[model samples]
Target chain A: MRGYTSDKDGYLTRLRRIEGQIRGPQRMVENDEYCIDVLTQIAAATKALQSVSLGLMDEHLKHCVAEAIAVGGDTADAKVREASEAIARLVRS
Target chain B: MRGYTSDKDGYLTRLRRIEGQIRGPQRMVENDEYCIDVLTQIAAATKALQSVSLGLMDEHLKHCVAEAIAVGGDTADAKVREASEAIARLVRS
Candidate 1:
């Protein structure tokens, strides 16, 4: 979270792999795999997605929001509000 | 993407399910499953995470950034820069 950009390559690498992962379940379902088997794959995908979300949130909080606050005043307020709204959106999502 | 807040619940629901998904692979690994089988599950998880990332980015673009720009001036400039940096970070990730 310190330098969100620093780990960009890693995150993208993981995301690219996940793009492949999404396709796996589809092929399984198309092949008429067992319900439980399909569900398990779906579950796995969902979990991986959550990790990305959490990571992104941390980056936003630790870097973006923190920087904005350092500047202080309206920009800081805006950044804080923006982060709160985003967090709310993420939580609700 | 039109109204990020509107779909917040849906996003969260998917994410919550993903949390469960993450655990599935762990159990599989612990069970000493075949390498291929474990990989497939991992693939599925990665795909799901990507979908969420895309959705979040879309929401940020269509809703959050849009609102900040509408306000205009320094806040608008700040929001736009923040978003561009975020997109850059995300792409790298």
Candidate 2:
């Protein structure tokens, strides 16, 4: 089971909100809104997405990584490595 | 007219795609997907949003901001200030 399984509903709610947020900029563009205004909406959506990422990362470390480390073996090392790479990708993105 | 007027279609298309991209994560969460996989999708959507912001910023600088600066007055200063703040928000987010 996934680390976020416990909070699946919460994550789904946030993601759905973000999906709606993205459409805000689309409507602004269709109406020829000012560039800065459209940009502001986009920035808001981007921040929302980032918040979700951070939340998921926290959950992953707390659950998945924690469980793997408890096992203490090659699996643990691979999990740590995989998580670090995922984090790097999150930071760069 | 907005700076992105020329590329309105492009911007709309990109925004629409991003809207769809956000749904990928929502579905993943609903299906109890791994935290890392869900995060990867979220990161992709965030990157796509950032790309759209950069494109809009480029257009703003080239057109709305440029035209305002050409006029050389208080409006120009305000426009520049607004654009700078927007850029700062983008960077922080």
Candidate 3:
């Protein structure tokens, strides 16, 4: 099981909400809504996505990484490296 | 008409593609995909959203904000302040 297994439903709900947030802007653009207003909505959605990423990162560190470290082997080293890379991508994105 | 009027179709297309990107991860989660893989997809979608915001911001500055500044009045000040706030939010997010 993945690190987020326990909170699977919560993550899915947030993701679905974000999908709606993204779609709303398309409608606003279609109707020629004010640029600032559309930007505001997009910012909100972006923040929401950021929040979700933080949550997933936390869970991954707490569970998956923790478990791998407990084993103390090449797998542990690889997992740590992989998690660091993912964090870097999230930060850069 | 909004600043993005000329690129409405392009923006819509990108937004629709982002919606799909967001949805793909839900399925990945449901299938118990690896944590890093899911996080990678989320980062990609987040980056795509950020790109769209940057594009909209550029258009807003070049068109709406430019026109308001060219008119030289209180409206220009308001637009500049508003755009600054939007930029701050995007940066924070």
Candidate 4:
């Protein structure tokens, strides 16, 4: 099964929550809620999103990267570079 | 259907390529490939990973976020905040 399949329930739940969280800001804008409050909510949503991304990245490294390495040869090196670049991008993001 | 479902094939192909890319760095380490070359490969992988993230984020905002806002009420503001925070985290990362 795909890594995603294993985490489907959790991922969907998080996404649903995120969906709700996103609505918060839109409503705030519609109602003209306090700027700080809206901004704070935005920040929270961002963190939540980052958490999701981090989780996925971790899984990718452990599964896909590890699998590639096990296969050996040029593929191993390719996997390592792929994982490293992914990490770099995550850090940059 | 989930957004991921629609992109399943593309995602898997990208992941497979990334898996190969990651191996490149590992082989470089084992074989003592040039540090510069390894680092360059790593950078490429990072960009590729970022591209994936950006695509996903875009989909999230368009589908889940938009759907939540359409429902209206407190949920709308919540979603807005969630999305903003996610973006902020991505930027920070």
Candidate 5:
């Protein structure tokens, strides 16, 4: 949380770039671009998205999760459940 | 990016919960808990991780990637490349 303010700007900047990537395919679709080309763009967008997620997950583990373990309280169990549920959703997706 | 500040607090809280969940398995391992239990916890942690990644990815598509396409510049190509590389890493990982 302490570092949140410091990192927020960079995170948002990266996200904005990613948002543009996501929209590329939609535009392609609207223009009736080649099937393979649109699919390729879609694939690219998906990967870009996964990258952002990976970075966030890494931060969460290092900061929030690590802190919870250090503190050792009810928060610990809640964190575990929260993480587990998140993983389940990812795999399903 | 504008929405970043608005959502920051909620995101941090969720991340903290995930952080605690990640450490649960580590503790279980250190305490010599049941083998199945440890593995189960590890699996849970992984799932939680995936969930966090998925959520962030979803947001990136909605925000960052989407916005880039709207702007229509060299950023468009850069965004596509950035996204593609990220996906490649995820699939490999």
Candidate 6:
């Protein structure tokens, strides 16, 4: 999350928009909109959120993980494990 | 994100906390804290975000997808595909 701080605002903005995207689908459902249309919107919103997660993961690797591995030790090992687990959780979700 | 609006505040609160958690690691990195420590914090933050995604997914299944399937048709097929792809993306992440 090194560069994350610098880009935090951008990320937050996108996530906020994503929240709206998600809300759009819910509203559609409430209005008894076509199920297919609602589902498609939900899919789009979900993908948008996933992109944020991917962006964070990229920054994490480029900064944190790389630095840890460079200064190899228990810390390095732990960083690797932490990242893998994070990826696993994302996949499982 | 059906019930998501009803519980939006709670979800937003948790996401904000996770944002702080991520910020913590960035600060740690800036301060040259141990790499393991920073990575661990990132892991926690990542997991927290994943939980949010899972909660959304669960609500989606129980509400949107369930309703679509109940009114089976092209919408049902689309809804199932949409959800499966979402799970796939999560797994790929």
Best by DockQ: 2
- Once fitted onto the true fold, the runs of candidate 3 whose alpha carbons sit more than 4 angstroms away are none
Question: lDDT of all the models against the reference?
Answer: 0.56, 0.93, 0.93, 0.58, 0.61, 0.63
Ranking by DockQ: 2, 3, 6, 4, 1, 5
- Mind giving the per-residue lDDT tens digits that candidate 3 earns over A25-86? 99999999998899899989988988988999999999999999999899999999999999
In candidate 3, residue A85 scores what lDDT?
A: 98
Model 1 chain B poorest 10 in a row by lDDT: B32-41
Per-model DockQ = 0.03, 0.92, 0.88, 0.04, 0.03, 0.10
Better of 1 and 6 by lDDT: 6
lDDT score, candidate 3, position A33: 96
List ranges where model 6 is wrong by over 4 Å.
Answer: A1-93, B1-3
Q: Write the per-residue lDDT of candidate 6 for residues B1-93, one digit (tens) a residue.
A: 453556656655665565566557555655645434544554555556556667767777888889889999999999888888777655444
lDDT of 2 by residue, A1-93 (tens): 898888889989999999999999999999999999999999999998999999999999999999999998999999999999999999998
Q: Report, to 2 decimal places, the DockQ of model 6.
A: 0.10
Candidate 6: residue B26 Cα off by (Å): 1.0
True contacts kept of each: 0.02, 0.94, 0.83, 0.01, 0.00, 0.00
| lDDT tens digits by residue: candidate 2, B28-93 | 898888899999889899999999999999999999999999998999999999999999999999
Error of 2 at B63 (Å): 0.6
Question: Per-residue lDDT tens digits of candidate 6, residues A42-91?
Answer: 45655665566677777778888888899999999998888888787555
Question: What pairs collide in candidate 3?
Answer: none
Which segments of candidate 2 are over 4 A away from where they belong? none
What is the DockQ (computed on Cα atoms) for candidate 5? 0.03
How far in Å is the alpha carbon of A47 misplaced in model 4? 0.7
Q: Point out the worst 10-residue segment of candidate 6 chain A by lDDT.
A: A34-43
